[model samples]
Each structure stands twice: as structure tokens, then as C-alpha cells.
Target: MLKSALVFRNAFKILKTKYLPYTKELQKVGGALDDEDWDKIASFLPFRQIFYDSTLSFFGSRYVTGNTFVEEIYDIGYRINRSIDDLNDGVKSMARQMKMKFDKY
Candidate 1:
């Protein structure tokens, strides 16, 4: 419960810092959204949705199973999803590379 709360808090911070600024600035300009503007906003949605989904899954699994192992597995799945996401965003981190290598084995 407490862990999920922390995750939600951090997610909100990321949304505010990384996403809200752009939207707010656009609104302030009173301009219609061009395709490029829409594309920029759409690009962030998948990453944000992943965070929300992982948080929900973490808490949901805990309540349903009450098993630490299950929770850990869920966490691992989320980490892998996040790594793939980062790779899609052009971030070739060590973890993402390792995941890709392991997938080929």
C-alpha cells in the first residue's frame, strides 16, 4: 500500500515536470494543436500509461495473492516493459541491451 502510494506520487511528479509544462504552454499560446504538437503529446502517453498500469498491477496482485514472490514477479515484468519502452524511445541502456540479448537465447 505504502509502496504503491509512493509510486503514484512519483508518477505524478514526472507527469507534471515532463508533460504538463508542454501542454500548459500550448494552452497559454491559444493556438490549435498541429500534427507535430499532437504527436509530441501522444509520444508520452505510452510511457505514462505503463507507469499507471504497473502501479495498479502491483497493488492488485498484492491484494489478490498476498504473495511476495508474485509481487516480485510482477515488478520484474514491469521493469522489462519499461526497458522496452526506453529502447523504443532511443535509450539503449545496459538493462535494455541485456534483455534483448537474453530474449535471443
Candidate 2:
């Protein structure tokens, strides 16, 4: 979970600083990204091509390569962070329950 959070943070940072500004122009391409644009996106992702292909497959044919790719990244990051927060909250709740049980004993 920590590793995922770290990776998410890094990826989101890169997306915000780098690719996000180009969102309009990139989307204008209609998923016909050139090599340079592709390289820019792939450079920050772990497992580069595999990650891209898997995301495309999971999210549908062109989610990763489509005009909304940048937006997708943002959404993915938001989901990941939300999941992490939920898990953390669950853990904290469990810990509190355990403490209450021990205190009663």
C-alpha cells in the first residue's frame, strides 16, 4: 500500500506538472499521438508499454491512448488515493476496536 501510494504520488506529480498542461492539445489529436507524445507519457510510467497496454485493456480499447488519457490518469490517481484512505481508516477502526476489547478485559 505504501509503495502504491508513493508510486501514485510520483505519477500524479509528473502528470500534473508535465502532461496535464498539454491535455488540450493532446486530446485534440483524437488518440493519434505521435512518437514524441507517446514517449513523454510512457517515460514516467512503470513497466511502460505493459502498463499502457494493460490499462487500455482494462478500461476499454482506447482509454489509455484516447484523447482523455490525461484525464484518465488523474481519475486513476484519485481512485488509488481514495482506496488507500479507506484501507487506512479500516485499519484504524480495527485497532480502536482491539484496544477497547483489551481495555474491558
Candidate 3:
């Protein structure tokens, strides 16, 4: 949730600094730019391309991989939860070890 928020905030910043300026310049030219022209302008902004690619990959994977994409996301979530569980277990194990060592002394 926090990560998504940061991504949106950064995307907005890029839009403000890069894309908005280009758009204002286009408006000043006194005519509407068509889809193709807008695409051309967007292509020149490297950050826009990167942002679009990342966002598309996240939401478009389903279109490319069908149902497997959903399974993949579930697997990733499970692994993350497992990793947190393992870390917690490790801390308990270490505390047990310390307790045993002190008891022996």
C-alpha cells in the first residue's frame, strides 16, 4: 500500500515537471494535438516510458499470461509472508539459545 502510494507520488512529480511542460507548450501552439502526436511527445519522455512500462507490466500481465498471472501474484504474496514468518521464528530461536546458555552458566 505504501509502495503504491510512493509510486503514484513520483509519477505525479514526473508528470508535473516533464509532461505538463510539454502539454503547455502544445497548448501555446494554438491547436489540438492528435493521439499520434501525443504518442510521439510521450515517447520522448524517458521517465514516462519507464512509468508506463512498469504500470502496464503490473496490470497487463493477466492479458499476456492469462490465469497464470494471478497465481504468480499469489505465490509472491505467500513467499513474502513465509519470509516474515521465518524471521520471527529465527528471533525466537535465538532467544531460546541465549536463555539456554545463561542457564548453563
lDDT against true structure, model 1 = 0.54
User: Can you write out model 1's per-residue Cα lDDT over 39-73, one digit (the tens) per residue?
Assistant: 44444455455447656776675465557546655
Question: For residues 1-105, could you state the per-residue lDDT of candidate 3 as single tens digits?
Answer: 333434365454456466767657656776344544444344334323333554566777556564654655454444333333332454345445544553465
Q: Write the per-residue lDDT of candidate 2 for residues 1-105, one digit (tens) a residue.
A: 433544455565456457755655556656334445444344333323334654775578533555466565555444433333332454345445544553465
- Any residue pairs clashing in model 3, and if so which? none
Q: Please identify which of the two predictions, 1 or 2, would achieve the higher TM-score against the true structure.
A: 1
Best TM-score among the predictions, by candidate number: 1
Worst lDDT run of 10 residues, candidate 1, spans 86-95
Candidate 2 backbone collisions, by pair = none
lDDT of each: 0.54, 0.47, 0.47
lDDT of candidate model 3 versus the reference: 0.47
lDDT of 2 at 98: 44
Candidate 1 regions off by >4 Å?
A: 1-30, 61-105
Better by lDDT, candidate 3 or 1: 1
